[model samples]
Target: MIAKFLRDPFGLEDAFPPLKKWQLWLAALELEPPIFKTDVLSTVNDMAGMSGKDKETVRIMIEDAQEYSREDSRIDLLAAAMGIPPNQMDDLWKWAAQIEPI
Candidate 1:
């Protein structure tokens, strides 16, 4: 499934493609601390630099977003908070792309 995105007929792939919200959540559970989907939000809000508004924004995104854009700065922030290296984002993207939508 991920191959379709990474290896398209068009030579160019989006440097930072948006991933489905469910895919992102699934990858989170599969990858690190292995927390429940519910905990993912709290974890991000708990990050050191997050403020009240930022926390609210994250909550809203997680609750309502259809896709999580790799281009969004918040994605990087979330990855960093989760101890994922910037260069290793592809791991998350690949893992995410494999998830079957619930």
Candidate 2:
């Protein structure tokens, strides 16, 4: 662990991977007002200004993603639904990566 830390003092290597879906949700729920899963679902449902099929695809991605990548097209809508900008989603990803799942 010490060697790994010395190799990458800022954890940039570890932080680059996609963040697990659950981690992001966990963080969101821990927020002051608490962003419920329903909040994200409803917001995504309302904001996707596209065909039903497209919306469904996006919804599926959100519901089933194991890890969220910054390059994913759907991520823009996902982040926006959470009131987070696409570019800023990296911050979410970095923070989420640090969450230790139980």
Highest lDDT: which candidate? 2
Clashing pairs in 2: none
In order of appearance, the predictions have TM-scores of: 0.70, 0.74
Per-residue lDDT tens digits for candidate 2, residues 51-98, read 878778878887887887767877777777788765566766777778
lDDT by residue (1-88, candidate 1, tens digit) is 6677667756444354578887887777776567465666768777777789988897788779998888788778677656678777
Report residue 30 deviation for candidate 2 (angstroms). Answer: 2.8
